[model samples]
Target: MRVLIAPDKFAGTLTAVEAAQAMATGWLEQAPDDEVVTVPMSDGGPGFVDVLSAALGGELLAVTVTGSLGEPTPATVLLHEGTAYVETSQACGLDLVPPERRDPERATTYGVGELVAAALEAGARRLVLGLGGSGTNDAGAGLLAALGATAQPDGVLASGGAALAEVTALDLAPARARLAGVEILAASDVDNPLLGLRGATNVFGPQKGVAEERRVTLDAALERFADLADRSLADAKGAGAAGGLGYALSLLGGTRVPGIETISAAVGLPDRARAADLVLTGEGSFDFQSAGGKVVSGVASVAGEAIRPCLVLAGQVLVGIREMRTMGVESGYSLVDLVGRERALGAPRDSLVELARRVARTWSR
Candidate 1:
């Protein structure tokens, strides 16, 4: 039997490649006669650069950029020919900020601009930016500032979203000049607009530690910046992605693309999974949200089209079996079911391997 293992990163625990490898190792340990093919997958988020770099054999270029909080951050971009893959998580990922210090009003995406600058310097005219897992709600103010947009005399640019209300002037000529010949594609996980109830500040602010008391303030700031910077993209699709970094890019002629589809095409996932007898895909947690536009959902759809059996192995399973069946997954397993929650969280790799071995033993001939 040929088994294709393609899964997204397990959030903070494992990369997509590492997860695929672990599942393959465990499956082979039990079913030695079976063939396993691994394909790491991402939805243009944290693992975007790493997965594409490995699959496309792109060169990784290192550069120093500003962090979410103005700290010096070492980052790398994947360059394949003239196309550059830049993951915003490399600079302003929520994981980079501590649990206690996560402040949507304070975090900035200045480092993204620095990375783009580095890619431009390296002769890249095609830029694909992965925009997700951000820790800011500045509507890309920091990014524009880094790309040569002048800041307010009162230091408004470096500050987070709340400071956007103090914007005194705008100078986008330099920033637009830098990206004149470049084609920018921002892969987004969400399609919310820049302002309103479904906007960045209201929908995503809480996850980054913005509370009711501060929500109105940040929303107003983003609105202020949107009006001052680019009122055209205020209601654009994906403008809310990555705490409004998508909005910033949209202001500079950046197009928004669905992340999973872009990645699937780049890695040729459908063609690879077509010949496999079974496909196993998963994530950190499998829940109702998994039915939406996620890596697991994308993988399952591909497998379904090929008439192949698809199974899922998750860290914590919340969706029901009928729901799994509807998604074309023959069955599903969660580490939390085999092992306790504590053990699953504390030792995920071991639990994942054990689960894979069990699945192979039960189903693989």
Candidate 2:
């Protein structure tokens, strides 16, 4: 029997690579005769660079850039041929900031712009930016600023989403000039626009520590920036991604690509699934969101295309059996359910390994 194992990062406990290895180790231990293939996956979030670098041999260029809080942060750009792959989360990821110190209104994406600049300086003519899991809500104001766009009052649009409310005008001519003749790909799965109820501020602000009362104000601020920049692109799909970094990339003429699809094609997941007897994929939580543009859903789709049975082994399974069926998953298991919450949280690696060992006994033939 042959088994294909693929998984996304289990939030803070483990990266996709770590999760895949743990699952493989447990599966092999339980069924030593079975063939196990591990493929770590990501949905253009935190582990985007590392995953792509492992799959596609590339030079990981190290660079220092400004972080979300005006501090120097170290980041990397994967240079494969003339294309540079940049991960947004590397610069201003929410994990970079502590929970108590999180302030979405004041966070900045200036470091992301610096990362782009570094890529360009390294002679990259094509840039693919992986966008998600950001700590800012600045709508890419700081990014544009780093690329040579200027606010009328200088410091009025220096940083953060709240500062956009005070902007009187912006000049994007210089930024446009700098990105000329470059192909930019915005890799993300989020479809929300940049403003309104379904937009960046209303839908994602709360997660970044935006107060309930400040949603409308921040949304209006982004609107104000869009009004001065490009109002038309504000309603475009994925404009809300990475705190409107998608929209800013659009302003710079970046084409949007579904992150899962991009990674799938790059890794040739369909062919791998077709060759495997059973397919297994997972994430931190198997919930309704897991069915939408996530690694688990993408892997399940690939497995379904190959007429193979797909299973999920996640940290927690929050969806019902019906939902699992809808997701094309034969069954699902959770580490938290198999072991207690304490073990799942405190010893995630061991708990996941034990869960995989148990599941392998039933699934492996």
* Model 2 CA lDDT for position 213: 93
lDDT of 2 by residue, 1-365 (tens): 99999899999899999999999999999999999988898999999998888778789999999999988999999999899999999999999999999989999999999999999999999999999999999998888888889997786655799989999979998998999999999989898999999999999999999999999999999999999999999999999999999999999999889999888887788988999999989888899999889999989988999999999999999999999999899999999899988999899889899999999999999
TM-score for predicted model 2 compared with the true structure: 0.97
53, model 2: CA deviation in Å? 1.5
Off by over 4 Å in 1: none
For model 2, give the 10-residue run with minimal summed lDDT.
150-159
**Which one is best on TM-score?**
2
User: What is the per-residue lDDT of model 1 for residues 116-173, given as tens digits with 9 covering 90 to 100?
Assistant: 9999999999999998899888998888888888766555776888889888777777
- Against the hidden reference, what TM-scores do the models get? 0.96, 0.97
To one decimal, what is the Cα RMSD in angstroms of model 2 from the true structure?
Answer: 1.2
Q: What is the C-alpha RMSD of each candidate to the true structure, in Å?
A: 1.4, 1.2
How much is 262 displaced in model 1, in angstroms?
1.2
